[model samples]
Target: MIDPQPDGHLPVAAEKRTADGTAPDLEHGRMINGGENLWMTEIQSVLAQSGTKKTTAYLSHECRMERLPHSETYLGGGREIFQKEKPWEFLTYTQEGRIYQFGNPAVMTVPPSSEGDGTFPPAFEIKGCNSQAHCPDRQIYYFDYDEIHERLLSNQISVRSLFLQVSWSTGGDDWTLYSPCRYVNFSNPAFQTSSYIQPIAGTVLMPVGDSFVPGSIACSLNDKGDHIIEASSRVFRDMAEWRIRQEQPPEVARKSIRDVQQVMPTFFLSQDHIIPINGTVRLYRYL
Candidate 1:
């Protein structure tokens, strides 16, 4: 579970960067929980001293902001409010088998570009994208390494599952593993692997928002193991609108916390209930 930075490579803190994501295993492999971050202190310190405030991050939106309630939780250990808490709050998209994103990926066909040394060749992200894929569905990120620039292009969600790893430098080039969006079906590298080593069973369930309206969404999972996702209609908020930096705004938006604030699971998975409880919560805020 060695998390590379949003972009592939960043040395982990000598102490925290245990060369892996979790505990070292001598036999098969090592698995260090990504949450045991060495930089938690720095984030806390920076926020504390710099007068920065923390709004809860969650699963559904473009930039991950899942700040759930748990023991030793960041803020006082009680239930944490995230994504500014939508009008009808308290659920996330992770309840169902939505291993990719809570929202849908906007589909666009890009031509080609000469900027990204060909990696982007005016593809989906190279050109421009529809403002639909932001929240929950857009909570994916890759390492921003000097090389291997992986952009979540505003196009179709082609891959079945994605494995995002983030590691970064802190003390003297030391790095820390952040969160992870582990089982994204849109980019599953093991798509070919068919043999099931273990048999598991379970159900997945998501929380629905206020059906108080005549037409409200009811989260549910359909057969064939697909989560009945809520496709957000025309996204109004743009990352540029919230930009606090002087640098040129990115052509594509990285998603806001509110988009994912459904606060309830989109649906539920019964058999082989595999849903992520705790993982990396990464995002770039405008304001």
Candidate 2:
């Protein structure tokens, strides 16, 4: 496990190359080439010195968005279908607090392509466990870059959106917050010529313990012409309530709740779209 220095900075050796002249692998918290390490180094530096909020802000303004081509086809039923001509590209990163698992304060960066210049930015970064209980593993599944890239290229998975989350702690209590989900265009090529109906409304749920708190969901096109789904404020309130019920340490419970007062609902990848709830659920569409 990785350890933080006394001043909270990760070891400078974390960014150094191995003795054999090969760059360190991501599992070791280092990149394969000198160029690829730039963004990861920046993220680590920001987190160690500036904290989570500033690190998140830096990523938000710097990371580049994927731009896939699109096409339109006319169906026999006098309907038109619009879909992406290529698979969506993305990079995944995960960060965990040092307090857990013997100070596992490392960030894992998985890029879409491992070759070339190696300066690509991540699509999103995730922190903490999504489950109601504190997950001891602290490692996200399917975080391998090769596995995600293969799935996307083979059309086995289609990602409609991505979410960013950050976690922080005070004393011994852990806290997490989420940003609004951003809609992305990813379509299955096999279904490109088929016509499908888009639903106008649905229910949104935030997972807490064994149950879920429900809220209203609506979909519309943003100014950029991207199809977006939004959840009502009820979901946020329910999440706050769940955090309170988790019986956090008294020292940071009140502060954690107060800091997350304006927390937004985070969506998860479910089939062709991103859903507000976890578990197996029916897919909803908004046109």
Candidate 3:
């Protein structure tokens, strides 16, 4: 587990910029097609780093948001309504037959934007169900990505990284996490087909004090052909530490050392799993 901050919060690193005062280079180590949009360029960088040849930038075709449900439920008659006031402490999504249970707040659900066409801007729609009462129906809440981008640019909000869960179904269901500019590989052979693919986007951390803590998406399958998805902060902590050690100078890394680990600027993590599914499931998040 990541060591908790002295003040009981996750460490936040300031956004890095190039010496020229431009966005940090997404393809720093490798030579790839540098695109106009920094976000898309960073995603392409990830694909290139993951051993994907002929990497190209693409926008998400569809996006959906889901969160883990509260453990306790309100029983009325024969129906059980998921509690909305308090969500489960952990983030999780599980599938059993047609019923799906999510354990985090519903982050986003919208169709892909057509603004830049082939290019990816920080453009998207944010919506969720109303949490005011124990309403069983989902309500439409609307917001734009420009507002979010403005907040990040102005330092009104501090986000460490944006994480996306990419999923597809071939003979079975396969999914992986994707973050722009992070080196994570989804080695499934089905990824090459690029059919029935969906990208679930969201932040990987929960708010703590003035900053956010890191979390990871863990995917698994069961004999019953069910998909088990979990949001694990512990796994994210380990990955962050490993990345830090890998980036250190060879000589400095050779020595035994203990440093407060922080999720580096423009960092992300992703994993892949496969199972049988009827259709695609997508997720997205914004704050």
Candidate 4:
């Protein structure tokens, strides 16, 4: 497992730049495993000799942080977090199984200036077919690409079967491939022809429901066809609070339950199985 340090330190050395501030020649930015020490040494030397301005200029102008797969696994690996130019987080909205991005050709065209005026136009053109028909059911979705990177690199769970490639006719000449909701109903003919596929870098999974609760359960199957039930910790902790409610007053119990519900650290998935160890740990299937 590539257990990258959480300090956000670059394990590999920042590449040496030319005197004219161009990037050093490289076929690709890939670095072999166990070669990080040598790279670190080179980077430290450059930083000490060149100081902050040179180092910043080189990284900003030539190098960019990107997530790369490990030598052994195709899933995920260490990633460097960079400060984004915009304050807003990148998000995508989906309408009628089609994705709409902000100010991009796939959705909207470039903003137009008011004719001969310095001010920009009130609105820009929306691209794509059936624009009016596809606007109503649009839902804002968040796909946690960073968390997927962490999960795959950490080897905590199998991500292979968490996604399925969906083939759908957009009423056009060609078909499109999309990753459906994990809890998508397979029996639905509209969502038929979804096959298991490996997720790529920056793959995002949005929640699978009309409304979301604090500890909603999302279900999916693994590559082995084992049902996986994922839920936030708040679900069980709230039950724990409910179990201990008799010892406290009504208001106190209510407060405790609410407190437990508010502190879910993360969502986790487990397979359906009963461990044959000293004690049984039964993981029930959600579906």
Clashes per candidate (backbone, < 3 Å) = 71, 0, 13, 0
Residue 261 CA error for candidate 4 (Å)? 14
Among all candidates shown, the one with the greatest TM-score: 4
Q: Local distance difference test, per candidate?
A: 0.22, 0.27, 0.26, 0.25
Name the lDDT of candidate 1.
0.22
Give the Cα-based TM-score of candidate 3 against the true structure: 0.17
Task: Report the lDDT tens digits of candidate 2 across residue range 1-287.
Answer: 34545543335574222232111111223211112111232111012113332221111112232222231212223232332442332222223321111111112122111112112111232333221111121222211233332333444332331122223443333333332223323334466732221123222222223222232334333223334443342211233434454678756766665555445422221122233421111221111
Query: Least lDDT summed over 10 consecutive residues: which range in candidate 4?
Result: 40-49
- Model 1 residue runs over 4 Å out of place are 1-86, 90-164, 170-175, 180-182, 185-287
Which 10 consecutive positions of candidate 3 have the poorest summed lDDT? 129-138
Better of 3 and 4 by lDDT: 3
Error of 3 at 219 (Å): 16
lDDT of 4 by residue, 188-234 (tens): 22465432223221122222122111112233433344444333211
6-94 in candidate 3: lDDT tens per residue?
A: 53223334222222212212222122121221111111211111232222222121112222233232222333344445443332111
User: Positional deviation of 29 in candidate 2, in angstroms?
Assistant: 25
**lDDT for model 4:** 0.25
Give per-residue CA lDDT, model 1, range 86-127, as digits (tens).
Answer: 422221222112212232211112221122211110111111
User: TM-score of model 2 relative to the true fold?
Assistant: 0.18
